[model samples]
Target: MSKVPDRFLGYAFCVGDVLLELDMDFHIISADGAIKNTLGAVNREQSFLDLLTESGRGLIESSVKMLTGANRLGPFVISVGQEGLAKTEFAVFLAKLPTAEDRIYMVLSKPYRLGKSDSKNAPAQKTEDKKREFFNRLEGLFEGNPDAAENMLVTVLEASAGQQLDDEKRLDIERYLQSFSVGGAHATQIADDKFAVVHDKTTPKKEAADIAAELARATGVTLKGATIDAAEAKLSETDSMRALIFSLQSFASGNEGFAVDQIQKNCSTLIGETTERVRAFREVLDEGRFSLVFQPIVDLKKATTHHFEALTRFELPPIIKTQWEMIRFAEDIGLIDEFDYAVVNLAIAKIRKMLKKGGSPGIAVNLSGRSLSNQGFIFELMSLLRGNKDLKQYLSLEITESAKIHDLDLLSEILDEIRGIGFKVYLDDFGAGAAGFQYLKKLKVDALKIDGAYIKDALTSKEDRAFLRSMVTLCKDLEIVTVGEWVETQEHANLLREMGVDYGQGYFFGKPSPNFLVAPTAAAS
Candidate 1:
């Protein structure tokens, strides 16, 4: 019998998720407690697929093959049950762990009952699927139209001085873009920090104008004439459609209007704010003027703290009180990577200390959006991880989807390098914007921290519940472990558990604190 690595066992306990390892021959190499408790002991020689429901075998196997290849497909949902027992479905996320031997590693979601006879779940699933379809069509309405010039009106707010928004502010802007639907105006990201709103001719020009005012008020950003009718572009007999689009690109560049003056005012305000932030950021860097407090992520099924998310706090500079303000300002000034590096180092230091004292709970540290595009910082990060190989499994990096990722291919390569060091990466605050799904498709994230809004309103709002169910179902289908943020009560936790949310974080579990360690006596109690 081959011995399983202690590190992998520690990983299973920290994630509160099942771990399964299979060889190239489709035979199980090992199964952790979660698997054993769910599916019973496994024989090493038994084929892994034989355990799955007959209907799901082929799909699961094919998805696994793609997962092992460069063109990896996302997670796959499959049912595992005996003939007499009702089938249970799980979303399974897989990764090829770097090892001397060829093997596939799986992170499995908790089982939820799935069958047509189950009346309780039928309507929710059906409604969510319909909603997803509607949104898909809405997205197409914004993106799929070939002759948008005829029916669509466009407005773009360009980023100045290579500055982009952090996730919170970007989501705020996206929300405002969709909030006013005068004559069914639809909004989509045509480019990074550049959004376009489209409405048919039926929409009154006044309503579109109101939308611009609404946007300006909501975001406090000035918009220049950047508006154009979809049909305004002249077609030439000699020029192709591509040439017409190239010409239209000039129209999108900028415009002349009162909004320009207001934008300059906004920029002036921003400049003053940026200077203050830069001074504060530098002081923190030189003096180590920050603190880290951890908020617990609870496993609903076990009612235990599976991990803690390290949150940063700055002091003495009354101007930068909130973590969001501090982080967002750092992002605006190209100092985010430095801030993220400091947080990661602090988190890793604490995590290492905890592990040495005989505890192995995981810690999730936030990585600022700007760090994704900074190759030098990424190289430094990779080197940092390589030097602390033992801490990899205990450490996870949380990347929020608030800002536009400038270079995804480069980010992907950086993540791959980090993953090669054995650490897990989580897509944090998912379902907040369009980028969530895009990142899911492009990256190899091990888990997802579902956006807090869905969890906060899930119990009271049917719409929120449906949205959550849909998001959880999507994550399950991809096999990504899910954590619900902003869970405030036992009722909320119980509701999320029923909905198949793997983990949760909120005041219901525990509050963020500087002293968040899992003491020996505390665990025993």
Candidate 2:
């Protein structure tokens, strides 16, 4: 056996969903600089949990052995089935890696597939059949009406290209064919290729391997072996790395093929799973799994607490570990509306709790544009508020300026109704949206929260400072209070104060806390 190169030896594998197959590749670089590759296929029909567990264990052991100098290895690259597949695969890979192998690099690649073509024997008869069908259809159309020969030719041209004929081209082809028919040269004018329909199908599987081999040549990895089962490969010291390379290549190609077939077979199943997850999340909302965290809004002039903005935190499943992941999953599964509604209700509940405890601080909660546009959501919210008069007094709704208010008339009517009910409205992230000024008169908002992007660099950037100053002036003229967010230091706070910003919020005042009522004596005053 030839010794593989030092640079190519590594354990790399692609991960995919249950119904979608996964392919893995192993590249082995022997001590003598010989490159060898191997391929692996993960069966999607089997239990994903069990397969993943086994694969993860193998990965950890291999990585540890490499790191301890028991074996030599290179970087591991993974290609996944879908968008979130990358994150899930990484998480599993991370969990399985030994502590000593923490420095091992991991790379992610875009999804790809192996090419498959029809059998050679099958194509000859199919092509002849299509040719007969085409000529027959053409003859029938022309014989029905001599004057329609032009239209029939245009149809044949479109059919050949596998697309609809444009009006101009159709008319031109019609005229040419009509001229030939009138001159009695139609039969002789037909080209030999025109009688037969040609179909350019994808290349065959073996041909695809050759193409992949060419690609691997550029990467300095050689195709060592191709097998149906990667795990069956002999894991000797010399062959281990080669096996890994072959596995990765097989996985990349096979996964692409599997993704298409799996989507066709189980698209509804996937959709149902997504819907169930969303439904479960909404159920969690109804069960009050959400809690409110408050961040202080400071009155810049008095240097005291103006109000507290309410943010929602959810107790997600172990699968969802990070804040971004949880929010993204919710958004992906179409549960953003439910999530936003839960946040509002949770914030309202916290406000009620605060009021009962004899602390009457103003509470602001964010409302998504989708929620605002939903008549049912607005009715449910209003009903909740009307049922509790005391909670309504302390409630303030903050809406992002970037929200696409599709039905402006309906939105304006809704805003009017919301104001009529005595709930204060704040236009969140002002200056971020194009029509911020235009919305001022249209929206019956009581406050404007300047976007954090503007406030963060206001002092250093003259343009930002000027924009903020102009915004402050515009708000004053309109009698709408302005609040600056992302005030991180005393300098930021001071500048906002000097510019007559009505309120400020960010790290300077306090970070978002689970306990809403905790306040310094000076801020409380």
Candidate 3:
């Protein structure tokens, strides 16, 4: 096996992870640790890109041009081919060795599956007998319904650069447009001085035109309305999706092309690609092909690791939007409950193994609010947690995802029961949602994982700093612990600790890793 050079030690990797030395053209020059077996039937002429799944190939292929000693790419998880374990997924990272002009180092860690697990799951069976229905209720425009408009009413309003944009004015227009009472009557600023309002199936052409004219007068902007009816235009499912993309680009770029069929790519790519990805996502959950990475949440006062939040990572096939998109899609398609159960199982299993090794480590797993809202799924999840009551002390739930949660009263009661059994609950993404304060008022959580947005801006903006101070005060008054996210620098850590944020989680603490990385304070001692 090829040895890792001394120059690349600044970047870290596990001992058994597959590493490779590749030339400027990305051809493998040297191999180390399972690369041969992982790729299977490897050749001297084959580039490192050949082994990667589609998404991985594109990311690495594009990102290497800017790679330097100070910068590294990824630790991003993606699918890769492996002998027997065809479904093998790896956490991939690459860095430039300072002196090696013709070479770069690539590291691939088996983050998801172990001996029995593979990166690619068995192909999902396509059966005509099984019937299914899916709802992608895209009422808004770019995802604007990314500008994914698929058969939605789009109104573009162009504003002159008048004395800068008034937030109050923008909010007024937004609120008015949203008052249409249609699902996803969403308004977005696609570009500077350009705003797009998207409405779903219920939006009437006459009503939209009236609103557009009224809004153009009110806001003093040029307003235009356009719609691409897939059925009306005799477009296919794929073409409709493409039309949305073209329309969004045209509007954003200050161009005008209401007729979409001419610009729409005449290929069956969109529908086929979406179908393939959805199938791949299903296979992932069905085959249990996901993995967990632990990022330390440190107790700021003692400067020790309070616990590690087990963030779920996916090893999906090429050409997907994002990991989160897949997860959100799972929730939409009624598959998140299964994925959530799998996560809880994995978290507890890892925690249990840690206890056996005489290491009293704690792991927090995220449970989506959408899943918790499901009565049956929550009951099943509660039963599983209750069954493994012993691991309750080691395993906690970081309740995130406030979007789908409707019955706060029931959710609060459910959380109280979970906490009643000794498991601490942390409200994830606190202060990021409209109902954050409402959730805080109702749900009895032990801690708050403060949203990264506020934490990121705290050092730069006084208003944000005031917000942090207020949040800390609120948590203090409630006697709840506070965890600040996106804490990347010593400055961030210092300020958060000074502000009395109880815990800190970010790259400053440590990044998510396969194994439990010790807290910085713990490491120093």
Find the candidate with the highest lDDT and give its number: 3
Q: Candidate 3: misplaced stretches above 4 Å?
A: 1-272, 402-404
TM-score, one value per model: 0.50, 0.48, 0.51
- Please tell me which model should have the higher TM-score, number 2 or number 3: 3
Candidate 3: lDDT of 341? 83
The local lDDT score (0 to 100) that residue 282 gets in candidate 1 is 75
Off by over 4 Å in 2: 1-273, 319-321, 324-334, 401-403, 433-435, 517-525
lDDT by residue for model 2 (355-387), tens:
788877888988766567656787887776666
- Residue 453, candidate 1: how far off, in angstroms? 0.3
CA RMSD of all predictions: 22.9, 26.3, 24.6
lDDT (10s digit) by residue, model 1, range 1-525:
365688877875554356777887678888775665566656788777877765366545533443323222223355665446665666555556544337766656543322233222434323223322333333333332343334444444554444556655655665455433211224444344555443444444324446556667877654432454434432111112222232223223333322323333343333344455566777987788888888888777777778889888787477677777677656644578888888888887888788789976788898865687777888888888898888877898988645667556777777777787899988888888656677877777788998888888888899999988998998999999999999888789889999999998887667788988542222544
Alpha carbon lDDT of residue 122, candidate 1?
Answer: 34
CA displacement after TM-score superposition, residue 317 of candidate 3 (Å): 0.8
lDDT value, candidate 1, whole model: 0.62
- Point out where model 1 deviates above 4 Å: 1-273, 356-360, 517-525
Question: Best TM-score goes to which candidate?
Answer: 3
Error (Å) of candidate 1 at residue 302 is 1.4
